[model samples]
Target: MKQLGSKIRGFFNTRLGFFALAVALFWAKTYWAYQTKFNLGVSGKMQNLLLVLNPLPTTILLFGVALYISGRKSYITMLIIDALTSLWLFANVLYYREFSDFMTFSLIKGSSSVSSNLSTGVMGIMRASDWLVFVDVAILILLLAFHVIRMDTRPIKKLFAVGVTLLAGLMFGSNLSMAYHDRSGLLTRTFDNNYIVKYLGLNAYTVFDGVKTAQTSATKANAKASDMNSVLVYLKKNRIDPNAQYTGVAKGKNVFIIHLESFQQFLIDYKWDGQEVTPNLNKLFHESDTLSFDNFFHQVGQGKTSDAETMMENSLFGLPEGSAMSLLGTSNTFQAAPAIMDQQGYTTAALHGGVASFWNRDNAYKSWGYDYFFSKSYYQNIKNDFLGYGIKDKLFMRQAAGYIEQLPQPFYAKLITVTNHYPYPLDKKNQSIAKTDTGDKTVDGYVQTAHYLDQAIGEFMAWLKKTGLDKTSMIVFYGDHFGISANHKDAVAQLLGKDSFDDFDNAMFQRVPLMIHMDGLKGGINHTYGGEIDVLPTIMNLLGISNKGYIQFGSDLLAANRNQTVAFRNGDFVSPTYTKIGSNYYDTKTGEQLKKLTQAQKEAVDAMTNRVTTELSLSDRVVNRDLLRFYTPNGFTKVDKSDYSYTQSKALEMLQAADDKNKTSLIDKNNGKSTMNEYKTDAPEMAGLKEFADSYSSSSSSASSSSGTTSASSSSATSDSSDKDK
Candidate 1:
């Protein structure tokens, strides 16, 4: 036993042996991260084995630097290096627990604000098991302290160190070659950071992130104020005049923007198994009070849903590569919907079921000048009412009703639904639609969840009518993005009975439902080529607000001479005549390649392409350089982010509503009782759930009348009122 111990000690005390041990420790931590935190998406055995082995070369090269010194200096240098690396891994572990994403250099630079803005009571996210991440470091420290592993006096030769580093470099080069062969453009076109960590390990991803951050910073620094003049001139030149007939048609009305998650336009009147897939949406779409667009497309990029939001709110494009909300949202200045409406005496708020910090929305919304933001913390019943994203659509709508009622009149509110998101999971009891046997489970399950979302919308609409909010509000419903991805194109083609699907079909599938419903409007189905970027300008026109002074990239869709060219983030665009993608132009009318073009046609296409590219580039520059800070519109006031605190917003809202008793607020009208019970849905998650019954039990029944007069219990009324008030 003594002999064995002596041999072990001797092995650990040598410089080469210690280097090997450091490499092994790094490998262990990398493996731990892969197993516990990262969603590497490794499918095959070979990929899994490669991931396990990928970290070795990088680790050896990094730890090899410690061999330059001998004795305690070398040992201490290695320890410090390992400690920092472990901390980096640990930080990523914590961040991935909440975001399911890796950290970037930009995120690390802004970590101070990120840490401060973390939602209160974050201890729930930290698990006792997470502490295991540091156990290896602790063991190493203990071994050093107890003299079980001694610091050697011998130094590694410089020649040997250089040879090992060169060997590691060669090994890493081989690894990259293999990764590139397996996943083409593994380093170049990696829009998704997860791909980097999966293919090349986290250390490589961090280095890449740092390089990208430096490039972004340099770009921002090099951007000149004079460059914005051309962008401004282009925007002014392209601006369209609002239609004389429809301008100010719904002025001073409450606006309810319902963001439908992952809903496609095909689902509007689509039928499954001889039954209507979205009966209520179909009814609304056909109603004379609703204006429905059949050709509205969602022009989102890698940011997807968040990109759609960015365009709808700011009349700007999302970044070409990553999410603008995640990368530039905290720092960029935006002349968004909330701020624009706020200029017209509109009280603006955003209600979402998910965490506000998911896409850094808590901070972004503040920058956008939202009067209030009711996120997951504001919801009353979300314990078991959640799926992968957040609270289920039915419960989220039902819970949102009370808060919606509390907002003052002339309010601009947005409700973001999440039930119909990717990997659409639905409770078996709630699924009323029969699944199609398309042989693809994801495509098959999509119908059920979309059907469930429709039901939730139906219930929310009914509540609006019951509470009389429908009478004063212009409800704008838009599908955020496509539910089904391109991976399921074959199955979708089979389901849709298409002989063969092409890029044209894929582009057409990007169409999402956009409907504007109000009581007094003469609504009709309009076939106009518009995208999410056009929504803000269109709505502003209807609300008697002019967006002429703002740096809007999109024109009002309701304008007579509206630019119908919809530019996608990836340099692709769709016009009335042609769809151009990567030097190839397809005739929109016939869906065929344009083999030949007249001089006029060529000039027109070139002009459109230039406009699209310029618009995207200008938007990127504005965001990346925070140019809005230097260029505020005529009627706009810069938002003070310090004025908003998502933590105390509920109390502030209640107090404000109570103070404005004579004004139109749902709380005052409902006699300080919640209207959650007025919302009814066939969601399976609500089965036998009676938690909302006692929400407003403390309020006296005899305090106020049904006429919405101020009541005695109004002082004790809170945002968490019971659903039993009905």
Candidate 2:
């Protein structure tokens, strides 16, 4: 036994043994990650085993180079490399918990913002068991500190180390080729980061993400304004005039846009266990004043929810790849909804319960010409109210009541709900709906949270009515994107009682609810073949606004001559007659594949394909080149982003200014007191948080003064102070 122990110690103390140990530790941690942290899907046993082994060669090639150096310096280099690798793994674990995604180089570059946005609440996501990832590192450090494995003086033979690295490289190449053979285009045309990590290891994904990021940056750097000219001409030539009857239908009215997070249209009238999934939404769908579109789909790409916002606000498409909000939002100029509304004397604000920095929204909102933004910080008593991305939908809507009342009349405001987000987890106490026995927890929880969201929206609508705003305001409710992904399709098929969901069903699943309600408008379900991109132009037309001079890609959906080709970001398109997804063509009426089309049908499909490509490419050019910076619409002044800030105090500043001026501010009209008390809900969380609501109400009243001149001066002084602090 003593002889065996001595031999083991001698081997560990040698240079080659130490190199072997490093590689072994890296492989173990990577496998651990693959087994625990990542959801690589059920890609069969062989593919899953290949994914576990794929990282080994890359790990060796990366850390093996240090073997060429001599003495302690070599050891130090290996230690640094291992430490960085461990740190990267650790970061992916944390990031994946939040985004269900691995870290990209772009996200890493923006880590400072992410770190700043993180709160103590993040500690809840960290599991005590996750410390297993560091067990090997800890053991290695302890051994080195105790001199149990002293740094060997001898260097590894350079030729052997180089040969090992080259052999590993060749093996990795072969492994990747096999992966591609198993999953066609495994390395190319990957839309989801999860797919890359699924087939190739996280290390491979990081390298791939870095390459994609570099390519995007290079494209942006080389982009020119002239590249958008063709796009502009196409958009102009294809632009349709607004229907005379519908123009100015909701002119000079307040606009309340409720963004339903991860909501799909199937939930609109869906029934499960004899209970309607969205009872309130069902009522809204049938309301005489509502115009609900049954066929409107959510056309978003990688940006997802943020992309929906971009398309709705600017009538523009998201990037073909990464999130446009994160990649280009801060730099890109936009002819957005808020900016267009500003021309018509509308006060624009965006209220989201999430961190403003999540998608770089704090800066993006400024560039989008939003005069006010109420982010996560604006909500009271929310330190414990959050679930996934931000506060619960119930709490968010309840908290937004005070802020909404403060906005000036004829305002453009958006309320973004997040409780219905993916992996939808609802507290047992909050789950009023029955859970599905489909065995898919995500699908089961989706229905419950969606019901909760509907209740929240119903409460908010009631509050609008109590405040007499509902009568005068146009309420637009739309789903941002899909709640369930293709992975859950089988379970969803069972839930929907389908034999099997094919591509046709998948296409239909993309449909999201778009409802517009105004007091005097005639209501009926409109079978409009539109997407989120059409929202801006539709809203503009109803409000007596025109996008004729602006570079908009979507036409007004309400227009009699509206161009209804719903172009998706991924070069797919859907029209009333046909649905073209990638290379497949389907009859929209029958949902049957058209393997061989008539010449006229073929011509129509070809024209649409060309149009879709042009639209997407032009939108990319406009965003990539920041074309709006070079072209301003006639009679529209370019927005000075410096004029806006989303700091916590800005909400109060705006309210105070409105009070001092005794102008369009709702607070001043309400006699300097918040109308939040008028807002009522049955949310359990809200009942206990009444004191928090009262505080907001009382604070507003306390800040008001009878003397207008003195109040104006004080507000001016406060604004100046805030500016200096900035």
Candidate 3:
């Protein structure tokens, strides 16, 4: 034991031994962060092994450089490198906590804009345990100072240093190979940063992001005005004329886009424990003035909610991998919905209960040309009023009424609800309904949160009617994406009463509710199939606006000859006649996989697939190449992102200034009195508040006055034609 201890001490005396120790500590800390701080979605034995192994190659490669230097300088250099790398990891930890995403080069480059507010956010999310990331560095410095570990002044052999680096390179190659084997196109086609960090290490992801950012920059740099010609030609050739019946149906009306987070179509009239899951939504879907579509799917990729927003606003698809809003929207030119509405003298605003930095919405919204953005900062005194993603739906709606009333009449307002997000959570006091018996906690809680969201929407609708906005405005409620992933297939199958879940079932499960409610409109559930990409063109048509010269990939859903094939981000598509999931084709009507296909069916599938591919590829090109910069559609002006700011004071100042000048704001029309008290919510946190106490109730009966809103089964359009493509 004495001899072994002496030998260990002797090894620690060498500079190489110190480098080895530093590498071990760095690797250990990274693995700890992976397991504890980040949710990399690690699964399976292979994935687990990869997660454990990924950090080593980068750590070795980075630390191995110090081994080439000689003496005490090498030791000092090693510590410096360790500190800097640890700082990077620490930064990501804080960043991930706020955005649930890793930091990118663009975010780092734009750090000057956020440096003032970064400290407060950093401190707020920081934990005592986070200091542990640097504990090893502190310990190593102390060891050297106290002479517990002596550093030898001998120089490392050049050959030995080269061999060490070569070893690291080989390790990284093997690591990447395994990652690619586990998930094809892990680097190229991923939408979530977690996937990259899960398969590769954080350092690797950073390097990959830098390379991608550079490539995107290069693509935009070489882009020319002529590049937009082919895009324009394709859109013009494929454009569908608006249907006469629906044209100008909502001209000059205020538009409210309600983004239902993680909501799915099956929940609209679904029963859980003998009770309607979304009773209010079910009622709204059947209202005479409501145009609902059960075939509407959310065509979001890895960007999820952000992807849906991008598509709905700009008629653009998100990047095949990573979020376009985060990666490109900040700098890329956009003729978004807000910009379009702004051109028509409409006040454009987006309200969310989450932080502005989540998905980089603050910068992206600016690029989108919104006049105002009411993020979490705008809604103050949020004492336990939040859940998984952001503020509770009821509370958010109640608070948003103040901001909404302040907006000018005929404004375009986007309200994002987050209470129904993943891992749906509800306090005991807020649980007005029972959880489902799906056995899966995620599935069970989804019903409760969805019901809660419906209740909130119901109350908000009542407030809208009370304020007379409902009579003049059009409300569009659409789900962002699927709530439950295929990971909980068994629970989903049990809830859906299916024998087994397959790719076809998963494809169909992507359906999300799309309901457009406007007064004086005779409406029914449209059998036409469409996705989020169709929203912008449909809105433009309804508003009596022509988007003829714009580079939109979607056509008006109300058009008689509109395309019915909805394409997903992953090259899969669904049409009225057939659905393609992975490499398999299925009959849309029968839900039967078509292993044997007739020549006609095969030809049809091939044509649809080609169209989907073309559309997605074109959208990708437009965004990646920043093609909008080269083309300005007729009657459209390029958006100046610098003209917008989302700070609380700035937003209020702009709103007040606009209202004073035009007298068109709803609050101005109402004689400048605050209408905050007019809004009500059943949120538990509002119970003690005297002003809202009278209006708050556990039951959602207040919003029942919307005619024909019943908790009955969905009303089918008996005579509606299913073939809209013709």
Best by lDDT: 3
Candidate 1: tens digits of C-alpha lDDT, residues 558-640: 77868788987766789778898544688898899887988988998988877787888888778887788778888788887
Residue pairs with backbone atoms closer than 3 Å in model 1 (clashes)? 695-722, 696-722
Candidate 1: C-alpha lDDT: 0.76
What Cα-based lDDT does every candidate model obtain? 0.76, 0.78, 0.81
Name the candidate, 2 or 3, with the larger TM-score value.
Answer: 2
Compose the digit string of candidate 3's lDDT tens values, residues 1-726.
999999998998887788888888888889999999886657689899999999998888888888888878888888998999899999888777644568877566544434433343366468888888998899889989999999899888989999999999999999999999988888765545778899889999989989977887798889888888778788888888877788888999999999998899999889977899889999999998898998999998657788899999999998765678877778889999999999998999999877678788999999999998887666644357766566789988887776677677779999999888766778998898898787876578888889999999999999998889998898999999888876567889998999888778988999999999999987899999999999999888888888888888888888897889999887789999999875579999999989999999999999998888888878988998998988888899899988998765556666666766676766666665555556767677977777333332211122122221111001112101111111
TM for every model, in the order presented, reads 0.72, 0.78, 0.73
Whichever of 1 and 3 has more lDDT, that candidate is 3
TM-score of 2: 0.78
RMSD from true fold, candidate 3: 10.4
Residue 492 Cα positional deviation in candidate 1, in Å, after optimal superposition = 1.5
Candidate 1 deviant stretches above 4 angstroms: 1-212, 221-224, 595-598, 648-662, 669-674, 688-691, 694-726
Ranking by TM-score: 2, 3, 1
lDDT by residue (tens digit), candidate 2, 1-726: 999999988999998788889889888888887777765553567687787778787788878878888899887788888878887888778656644556777655655444442444256446675666776677777878999899899857889988988988997888788778777766654445666776677788888888877877787778776766787788778878877788888999999899999999999889989999999999998898999999899988767788899999998888655567776778877878898898788888999877778778898888889998887666654334677677788888877776666667779999999888766778886889998888976578789999999999888888878878888899999999887766456888988899898767887888999999999987799987999988898898888887788888887777786767888775678888899864579999899999999999999998887777777877877886777787888989888889887766655666557656545556667776667677787777666765556665665455455422212122334433432232
TM-score of 3: 0.73
- Order candidates by lDDT, high to low: 3, 2, 1
